[model samples]
Target: MLKGFLHHYYAFGLKVTSDWALPCSQRVQPTFATLEFRKQQAAFFAARVPRALRSQDPARIHYHDLEDGSRYLKWRGVFEFLISPDSQVVFGHSLDGAPAAAFRSYMLGHVFSYALLGFGIETFHATCVVVDGEAIAFLGDSARGKSTLAAAFLADGAELVTDDFLVLGREGKGYIAYPGLPRIKLYRSMSKHLLPARKGQRFTPGRVPKYLYPMEPVTKPQPLRAFYSLVSPDAIKSQTEVRIEALAPRQAYLEITENTFNVRVQTRERLESQFRWATEVVTRVPVKRLSYPRTLKVLPEVIAAVRADLQASR
Candidate 1:
């Protein structure tokens, strides 16, 4: 249980109050915030969680669905999060003597996505940027250059909307993409090429180290204009050209389904709901396949192709 004073921050279109300092834009305390993060002992929260409903990743993470619609998520050697049914409050505890940075990483990444799911918000495993008053999303699997592409756009003065977790909310006839944490992760080599002057903090320090490059985040939500599903040049036989191809509605729906964030919380009802939501999104918005050579030298051309395609659509 959290006592005393709390810090308030804004991200993912929600006002969050936390007992710890979060890597988000600070905001004035609202009368009623949308989410609260509380620090608690492991045993305190564990006693409240139900038995393990299932384990999403046996070696990495375990998930438990509480009786009152809340969720309990445990990441091996990292942290445990007990989220309220309404997704309004989160109780967290570090596990296996994990560092504070590691705990914060999981909280902002997977645990945050879980709360968004509980809030009935549609999300994707993509990075987004604001271009010409509209939001463009790049959807792909890990290491498929989504962040690298977004970094390229940011270098060209495009404002970053979100990275890794793209949150969407229905607004009138269209959808709005909300801002996430104001950072993008990129490889050291890519960072040197794209943002040479900016020194970023090491996110994953290993053989292939990734740096978290900070950027000016889009403060307001932007209207979602299009989604580009990134495909590697190697994926296509004998392909070396940068091209944009429109996806049929069915294909678009499947792409969105596959790129949804946090598949562990996807129950039968949630899947059905997602199917319907994805159907609507595909019918209304354009989803295209963007294939380009995986090299830093080709990024500008890739950006130009994307801009031309967006303009052509409009």
Candidate 2:
């Protein structure tokens, strides 16, 4: 039973359902209650959500509220989310749900999936590279160095496309522009050697994350020309660099599967769909590996190399 309500994301049309009913039944309700709850929640999310969120689309931002009651449930992770082409769903346990972990997996996966689906376009869980009116995406595992590379590029004067995710859209015969959003997580640990940032700068241990320069103006997405993942351990010279090259389809699939956090839940169809997306991305935008080192001094060198490569390709 839901004690709260459901809401939809204004810009993305994400639907979220949650429990609002107090003292909810421990057992699951098959039909009536569930349906009623879903409807009510949906309306709640839709009606209450403002038209503008984080100054972006007000219509696309959606959320849910649950009243599981019983704070003793101690549920830390209790949420779920699902991503389909046209829509997405996010759910969380009521107060009685007991633990966030209960919802972490589902919610996280659904969010990741939504990000991957391109927020209605094609999206990747990585930083974006914008150059020559074009955008390239970097995808990888949590600590694989995508943000480091993006930061590296930024240090070299390239405009930031997006820190984490970007929405792709059609533009003048080619798809372009990153969607919305800002602020990428800089793992305090990883930044130790990756950027010039200092340790204490971060609120806690890990990378010294920072907002993009000229913060007042939001970075816009441009045409996409390439997608790369930082594989770590590329030949290190006095200066590290992002080596861009074409990858065999097999290798691309392998790399994507390896980087995917929820690989097991990815069904054959889902896998195929992902592959199809990857293939399309590869065919249109070259996919490559961005291998570099833990040094901030060499960031410019890496960005320079990418710029040179883009110029050469153009």
Model-by-model lDDT, in order? 0.84, 0.46
Instruction: Estimate, for each residue in 116-141, the C-alpha lDDT of model 2 and write its tens digit.
Output: 34332334556676666667677776
Residues 1-314, candidate 1: write the lDDT tens digits.
43764787888888888888888877432222388899888668747864453223556788778778888888877888889988888988887788776788889879888887786666799999999889999999897899999999989989998999888877898888888888888898999988898889877757988888887787878899999999854586566779999999889988999999878865887888888889999987889999988877888999999999989988
Models 1 onward score TM values of 0.93, 0.58
Model 1 CA deviation exceeding 4 Å by range = 27-33, 50-58
Worst window of 10 by summed lDDT in candidate 1: 24-33
TM-score of 2: 0.58
The residue ranges of model 2 lying beyond 4 angstroms of the native Cα positions read 1-89, 93-122, 166-174, 187-220, 234-242, 253-264
